[model samples]
Target: MVKDEYTLVLVKPDGVKTRHIGEIITRIERKGYKIEALKMIQPTEELLRQHYADKVDKPFFPELLEYMTEGPIVGIVVSGTNVIKAIHNMAGATNPVEAEWGTIRGDYGREWPDGNLRNIVHTSDEPSSATKEIKIWFPEFEFTQG
Candidate 1:
């Protein structure tokens, strides 16, 4: 049997509104990960507040909250070998201008009013983060033994 790893993925508001969901998922699947769980939901202020607690004190917090809650997004839990790093590479840098071609952000991101890249997707930066984020986004969706 093939051993697999897992990662958390977020098809951000822009990606969802732009109708890039299928393409993004296809890219991940083509990279060899399996979509273990997927859902579309509008995040609440409380959820965003907690999810981005690390950024709460930043000057961009308010706007970030506004942007995140503006529309529905797809939350996904994907699993495969070395999936965490693979997914991060697929997501690219937070700033689209700095991202290379073929990455999700590089292809679909836009410059925000604040001059930062409001990239169209998010992936956990590491395995620990993936575990934490997955739980936050999918509390009721349990991971079973493969």
Candidate 2:
């Protein structure tokens, strides 16, 4: 088992403004995942650009970045067994309309007719993404040795 494996979870701007942070935390806890560290942040432009570098060329990327910076986000380091995949499943799809009913996005998020995706949460895609996202979001954080 991969003990202490962690994933980066971002309760996005919409989630924060909607006061869904508590429910999100509750669900994470209910799933038996541990929150190692958490904070609210207003991400800088450079940080987000780097984080979403791959999408920079896409037309919708600007709106995506703008939406992310609209409000403060709750960033958390969540530890659990196979958290990368497990958390992804719990978060559901990026588009709430297509997400499964029980998942976070499906349950709490809404779909806008203007084609904007208002998904409430974002999780690291895999181990590599988790590592990169952790570094981007929490550079000063040091992992304690077991």
Candidate 3:
């Protein structure tokens, strides 16, 4: 039997900077996804490092860190059938310029002349990623093992 899935969605610093939090949440609710928990966080370097452990060594990590820490980010725990993949598709491409028109990134994202890529949102790519990210962003929530 298929179990309902839970995933993490983050309105990145750019999303908050551009004031798209309400619209983003509205889209999630409009899709009939349950928002289990939500919080606004001023991300720290340590938390970001742990959240992005795989990318810490990448050349763009520093820039990413700067961008993420520039302002507050909204973390949302969403639950529904196949929500991980569904929300991922809803978030659109990593680059706003490449995203589809109906997706969140394409609608609210903006390009910076300084070449900083400020994609508006982040969603876990898969179940495992959701598990880990939810722990990072919503540590107080307990997971029920299936």
How many clashes in each candidate? 1, 0, 0
Please say which candidate is ahead in lDDT: 1 or 3.
3
Candidate 3 TM-score over all chains jointly: 0.97
Tens-digit lDDT track of model 3 for 1-146: 78888999999998998889999999999999999899999999999998999999999999999999999999999999899999999999999999999999989886899788999999999999999999998899987643
Instruction: Give residue 126's error in model 2 in angstroms.
Output: 0.4
Instruction: Tell me the lDDT of candidate 3.
Output: 0.93
Residue-level lDDT of model 2, residues 13-115, one tens digit each, is: 9999999999999999999988989999997889898788888899999789888998999999888788789899999989888999999999989987767
- Residues 1-146 of candidate 1 have per-residue lDDT tens digits of 65676788999898999999999999998877899999998999888876787999999898888888879999999998888888899988888889888999888887867654468998998877888888888998787766
C-alpha RMSD by candidate, in order: 1.8, 1.3, 1.1
| Candidate 1 lDDT for residue 11 | 91
lDDT of 1 at 110: 70
